[model samples]
Target: MSADILTFRPAPLSQADAARRRAMLLHPSNFVPASAPDRDATEKAEEQAGRFDALYKEFLDRGLSANGARTEVARAAAREIWDGFAVQLRQHRAAGQQMDANVLAVALASIQCLNSVLPRRPEDPHHAVRAVSTARRRLQYNGGLLHRLHPHRNPAFQDAVATLQSLEVFLTRPQQHAA
Candidate 1:
């Protein structure tokens, strides 16, 4: 025998309820009004606007949406940060701070790429995989570059790459446990 499931029915909304809904939707608290200073700041904002011009060109070249270009901009910013970290690794070596420099570079690159993604679409499995791939590539290329710069083909370079491999395994675990 199948049991019948009864669900509760909500009463029809009255005119007052409709009005309240409209009021809530249009509430001032839901929107911040721009002040005169805000307007002035935008009008006279120092030239960051010019930066987006090439971004538009990049989008046109790639036949991508503005949003896609914006995402690429975030990824590029991470790469730039990793480049700066590469310089720091050299400084650390000169100072006799002797942990594997490439390892440090891998960690920094992984962190940068992970942090770089904006408006993350974690619900999309493909996007999550893509993020992991980007991180892995950054770590791999940085390690390769560091190895090329080494004077004597030391084992430390191999160890550094191994460290990055461990990180990649840690990073690419099945997404179900990721959350």
Candidate 2:
């Protein structure tokens, strides 16, 4: 008696089909990743964003239309490109770090909108500035707990403070260009 073995195999897609799949995976409009204040992470995310833009532009040049597949693909690309930032944001939120959480949340949300479609703009610094401003107001009302506390005393606190500071600097930079 011989035993029969079963193997699973999936169907292969054509080049066009595969391209579509990749586009779908990369498109993102609402969900955006947060890149915190680390230079490396921020730079890496920025690089990926540029790549995403190039890919989307090529897709549009292909057959993708703004009102059709292109829009979806762009959204996917945006979400996937910045996916790393989400993890950092979630961690900060889990740690109950208000300033970090708010800053990242604002940045991510703003960038998503800015890059969602044609005439897509770079992540607006205004969103980040607004976030920090709101957080500062909260801190003032709450007796400036973060300012009073020493970051060096706690590693996590130190990281959170550093991130907030860096994010503020990043946000404030665009205004210089405008002038």
Candidate 3:
């Protein structure tokens, strides 16, 4: 037997191959098939809206003003979304698998939502602004990396970016006091 050890080196993927791989990784169909019926989608959306309306009505019944009820509902929803993301992140880490782009997008969006609902500290009004600014910078950097890797327009990613932008706007606005 020869003393030399042979190593196998795979050839670089062609552009078409790269594109196909990216599509496989980033395609929405991987989670929910693109061919899913429109009726199912509509039903799911309507169900979610109904749940929100029920919760809002419940809060109103509890004697909260409409604005207060809306704020409370937003906070609760944001908390739930953030908690779900945390669980998914933990699961992915436990499995030693790289996070899917969609997961990252959802997590970022959840963070934005949570930030928007968080009550600013009277003593440190600028704290939220600074924190959100830092987060936005980091998110933009990572988002750019994800875009480069996937080389596709992901609607989830776009929505997450938009959510972050909205959070920035929310942070800049003066706090509204309930009269």
Candidate 4:
């Protein structure tokens, strides 16, 4: 068989425009998942989870021993991370969709992130206690809600329950606060 060859034309974008397009595509606000609510929820959740992980690492790797300026910066970073997560959650709920894989993914990532942040009690006992308690509350809200949903249908709930228990252990460990 004889075939005619055709030249293909490609559309070109300016460097600045291309950069902007790439940024928009990568922006968390526009992230879309394969599934409904779940995809968006999962992406948003996981993104926040990563932020949590960063904060945890920062705290663990560089405790309050860091200079006051550095500590302030880290504290601001942590606050921003948490604030972003809270905003995403509110937006998801406001959208009025049944929670799905995306939401679950977010919840799972959140649990993992919080776990990573929990400090060992013997070191900075005061901060460790506070971090554990905060993580426990978040785990309770994230895990408890997911667990209560069709308990018989999902075995994964058990893992979430375990995560919750781990957080609780961190919260309740005995520590005499420094005077």
> Best-fitting candidate, measured by TM-score?
3
lDDT of 1 by residue, 1-179 (tens): 22332335555689999889866855535443323335444333223334434644575488755445544444444454456567768876888766555556555755465564533752343453466456655554545454444532334333333433333332343423321
Q: List pairs with backbone clashes in candidate 2.
A: 26-76, 26-77, 27-75, 27-76, 27-77, 28-75, 28-76, 34-85, 34-86
Pairs that collide in candidate 3 are none
lDDT of each: 0.48, 0.43, 0.51, 0.43
Give me the runs in candidate 2 sitting further than 4 Å from their true place: 1-73, 112-179
Point out the higher-scoring one by lDDT: 2 or 3.
3
Q: 63-178, model 2: which lDDT tens digit per residue?
A: 65533333334345435423634676798899998777655554455344324332342243354345444443332222223323322222333333334333444334433231
- Residue-wise C-alpha lDDT for candidate 4, range 69-154, written one tens digit per residue: 22333244434444544555566567763464445455546544443453222334345435544654554455544444334223
Of 1 and 2, which scores higher on TM-score? Answer: 1
lDDT over C-alpha atoms for residue 156 of model 3: 42
Q: What is the clash count of model 3? A: 0
Regions of candidate 3 where Cα sits further than 4 Å from its true position:
1-48, 101-106, 109-113, 121-145, 151-179
Clashing pairs in 4: 38-102, 42-102
Candidate 4 deviant stretches above 4 angstroms: 1-100, 112-122, 144-153, 174-179
Q: How high is each candidate's TM-score?
A: 0.31, 0.28, 0.43, 0.28
Q: Among all windows of ten consecutive residues in candidate 1, which has the lowest summed lDDT?
A: 170-179
